[model samples]
Target: MRFTTQRKRFRDLSEQEIIALAISSEEDDAQIYRGYAESLRADYPASARIFDGMASEEDDHRARLIALHQQRFGSTIPLIRREHVAGYYTRRPVWLVENLGLDRIREEAEAMERDAERFYVAAAARTTDADTRRLLGDLAAAEAGHQESASDLANRHLDADTRSNEDATARRQFILTWVQPGLAGLMDGSVSTLAPIFATAFATQDTWTTFLVGVAASVGAGISMGFTEAASDDGELSGRGSPLKRGLASGIMTTVGGLGHALPYLITDFWTATILAFVIVFFELWAIAWIQNRYMETPFFRAAFQVVLGGALVLAAGILIGSG
Candidate 1:
């Protein structure tokens, strides 16, 4: 009974602990916003400027809280975190956060402001000390005001021209991050797998052998391409991401793309397998064309023409080489 009571006491945090946790959270959020700002300084200058303003606001809030903390308690604040609480939202690393579109980032900024406001308000309610309570209330109000402040800052920094530029830059980054790598993978997988698959089909005239060769080619190509992409760039100039991560993404997609057509060869009938394989190839080419048009901003006709032409050339080359 005594051990149970002690465990319960250990699980609960005091008011000061909660306050300290809030402070640390604010500091971490501010640093993340600053990092995001720095990352977009070159390409999305307007968005970067807005994030810079937000970071400054976060810094100001941190300073005010620190001063208030020192006045109420002491110069030294104890370390505390959200995890110390039984049910608190966890903060994610900035890099790992998905959907970094401009509107999504803006929404994230708004969410941060809302969370800060709620945290401060809750802290103020829990505090017994008048000064601490007052400080927390003030901080809460300030955080509440940040939503409008962020918008005003955006309006000031992101004029029509700047906004257009930022949009264009964002589109470009999207292309570089996902589209380029995915497209390269798709092209490699679709084209590279063809030779082994068709060669085995022609040589043995056996569906099982052809299917096995295709599977082997797809898997091998995926692994090879993934490593090659990851090792190719350190992302110094590209700003994609870690080479290993991007490479893995690219490689997996490439293999999947190639295997789509190859898998049809699993059919025992030669004519059926050939027909399905051709159909898959057609679909693969169309999918690639769509991705180029959608993400890369290429015209549909142009993308279709380019992808189809390239695929045909590769197919012809594979057949010729296999025959030779």
Candidate 2:
């Protein structure tokens, strides 16, 4: 996916073409670093400063590479880049990378340095010309130096306390944006649909009919829950993060929770499907308990007791009602 084309091999490039490619690569890297800086500027200012420093360093590298190109081959640089070179590493779009997390962005920055260094080393090996080989070796050294510089840059911008706080804040944001909403959705879907689903199952004694009812219950509940969560808070005041993200987490998990038991009813045999559905319901209740224990930090046994007892009561009620 990273390779757009394999038209030009590394060994095939002339010294002038290689210089042009290096210059363009530096320019693109600088632009990407700047994009990262802009992306993290608001929430994580310290991290943004680190990226800003990196961007500035990349600009300096580009300028140096351009000067070298001018001195060696007289200014009219060729339009060569990573995409033109076979086996050259390319950068992921900044917008996409930034969406991963704070830690991931930092890792990506480090990876960029390593990728550049490796490319330069590989280019050096491919070139027969002494000057070009040496030039590439120097470029490789410069990229390796960037790793040290990045450490110094981070030290200047991010103190231990600040880094710890930023990481904690990011974790909290993740929990608020995804885990909490998803847990709530899973709980609602698994517990709320039990009565109607089981009652219909017992009453009809028809696997196909039961499956239909279960699907309707699950999907309807999922949609209602998703919209309710999204509309409940805009995340402006609550600090829960994006409405869209929370809605997606809630909606997807809600559907999954209900479908766990519902899917078992697809079997043609009535008793077989019903037995499987019951087994699935047992696991769903336990899973809800586990999630509560894990993320919500509820006592495991207490959560299990509450979930299992409530589910059992509901199931019993459904069976009694169906029998009558």
Tell me the whole-model lDDT of each prediction, alpha carbons only.
Answer: 0.78, 0.87
Off by over 4 Å in 1: 1-12, 74-76, 97-107, 118-140, 202-205, 228-246, 267-272, 295-299, 309-324
True lDDT of residue 124, candidate 1: 73
Query: How does model 2 score by TM-score?
Result: 0.90
lDDT of 2 by residue, 66-117 (tens): 8988998897999998888878899998888987789999999999999999
**Candidate 2 lDDT (Cα, 0 to 1):** 0.87
Q: Please give, for residues 191-295, the per-residue lDDT of candidate 1 as tens digits.
A: 777767776776677898888888888989999889888899988886886676678778988899878978888889987997889889999989988988887
Model 1 residue pairs with clashes: none
RMSD of each: 4.6, 2.9
Give every collision pair in model 2: none
Reference-based TM-score of each model: 0.76, 0.90
- Position 107, candidate 1: lDDT: 72
Minimum summed lDDT over a 10-residue window in model 2 is located at 1-10
